[model samples]
Target: MSSESTVLIFGGCGFVGFHLVRHFVKTSTFTSVAVVSRSAANHDNHVDGATYHSGDLTDHDSIEQLLLKIKPTIIIHAASPSPVTGTPNEYEHVTIQGTKNLLKIAKRSKDVRALIYISSSALAKGPEHVNLDENHPLANTDPKSSAYARTKALADLMVLEANNPFPFSEPSVKETSWEGHLLTASLRFPIVYGTHDPTTIPGCLSALQKGQIAFQLGSGKNLWDFCSIENVCAAHSLLVQALLNPKRSPGAAKVDGEAFNIHDGSPHLFWEFARTVWKFAGHRPKNDKVTSLPAWFVLALASFLEWGYWIVTLRTKRPYNLGRQQVEYACFTHTYSIAKAKERLEFTPKQDFEGGLKEAVTWSLKQDHWDEKLKHVTLTN
Candidate 1:
């Protein structure tokens, strides 16, 4: 806890919260940044010393009046939803009632100190065959898990039981606080590419500019792990300065309610990261002659189109809004373990996952749907 620090950012105009409000507005250790966002052009109003506050994280009195008017000292929950307009009850209404209304407004923001949270390496574990970590094992009954991994494993156990100390006098807890409050952390990430990737490569380049690709499912040798949106915002600013300086990690109280796995600990495969985005997008496309399939026949055709969108939303009464976790994340395969964020958050992922997929395929081949049969399917896949 040094000089300037007043962070607050819940989904700060998204895409990794707009690269964490442009790295906390070019940090000098953020002196006030507020954000909240539900609209107001989705916030990121060019962050310098930030301040946006619109609303809607399950509207608990608009996040308790912006957490009692920006009483922040860091509280970044990067707001969820949008696995295509979410469901599974909108992932239990914004990732578990918007993280219990942002931990009931960070237990009444008593100068909030640290909260972080940003979860999703599909709720701590999954792509096994070895290489997990951060005490992996929260699959929460993985019957091909998703409703965003059981609401991110019930919102990482409500931020580790809201960092105990008799969480509201513990007998079946109920949100009490003070007595050293906000110092919760949980950054499970992965598949978090760069430069504003609104969920997985700009939604796979907006489903290849609305063509809505049909085939090409799995056997693109699964493998996952990826990071860099400035190395996951410099490993969340060195795990919030090793949780506000605990001698910079003398095993910070045996890893305070831990959950690590950020990524880039190398593993690429998905069609060799789609043939280095078709040779760094110098002209390949049409999913470069797409033709792979077999991860149990793409999870048995996405479990028969998730039972044909659950019997066409129970015979078209309503509710369809797509997502079904992209056919169980196109036949899963996450692969993490950044060795406890490179041994207690010293963290080090500089990007070069095939050089950031050739700079997100040379900026998606300079946009306008790079055609020519996608450059002859990128010169023949």
Candidate 2:
């Protein structure tokens, strides 16, 4: 990479995006840093080291202009429908359409170097298995599913195939004529939890506050690889910086099209993780009885609530909101192996499950967000 290399990150306002933006901006390696989001959020303005551009991923014109203006060498497309937000179609629009827009932009950006997509491990083939790697097929036939998973799977395919160095079909629209191949890396992340976690933390807290969480979801033995937001950001940065290194990178001849399971390398059961939060928050499990809700019932309830809201509001909004998905997902076991990333990207998670949860709980207390009664819980032990 040249000293003139510019890096542009899409969707830098959301949780994982915020963490990535902070990491890239502070690195001081790039000539300039730019962030493009649907709108300029409060946190966007506060990113001292980067320039923030207001642009929506679904808007082709905005994306074109943003690409033209920034002329980035490294593009990090982290913008998409968050796992907890948007209906099924909305997920398609953001993940698929947003990616198409970015790819179009990348085709135009003559100086572009690498494009790294932060995808989800929720796209894994084995929602029932313990530990999965990149080779596992996606759970394409899961009857009980969320739109988020489906769209991510689609987008991931688009990305991998888009790499010209690979033997995939070329997109009809090439915004700009390309000189060489565009390196694409798909980093699949697991149940990411950390500071600025607008969705996960709040939903969990709401259930606890309402006394709705009685027993662990399922048998509570299903393992999940819960990653820290900071660690996720760190690994991404390492990958980006490595792309600038000629000896390390796959070079122009290589597609650099690879998928790596990104996690903290440790799997924790749903009950085990929940118990940690309860202890830290100074609360006892609301319901001691472990009752099992069949997967069919959970999905049915979720669909009913989702459709009911759509009917009532005349909008495709989920009725139970983000909480419904959390309840359902908590029952399943999901884990991934990050060994590839650790070896290739020189990545190591800085925060483990225990430390990350503790920090998150502390931040919640500072915000006065948690139930006041549980504030005195012995967190240190």
Score each candidate by Cα lDDT.
Answer: 0.65, 0.71
Q: What is the C-alpha lDDT profile of model 1 across 263-381, one tens digit per residue? A: 77777765455445544544244444656666666566555666676587763221222344554455556686677778877788775776666666555455434543354342432
User: Judged by lDDT, which candidate is best?
Assistant: 2
Report the lDDT tens digits of candidate 2 across residue range 1-381: 565667888888877887777777787767788888877655533477888888888999878887878888888888887676567777878888989878766865676757889898887654464677787877555654556777788788777776654123444222333435676888898777887777666666655566555544466767778888877877777777665554542333332677877878777777676667655666654435666666667656766777676788776666554235665566677777777787777788765688889888767756645756444443322
- Quick one: RMSD of model 2? 5.0
TM-score of each candidate?
A: 0.32, 0.85
Off by over 4 Å in 1: 1-7, 10-14, 19-33, 36-69, 72-74, 77-114, 117-130, 136-179, 198-222, 226-256, 260-271, 274-276, 279-282, 285-334, 337-381
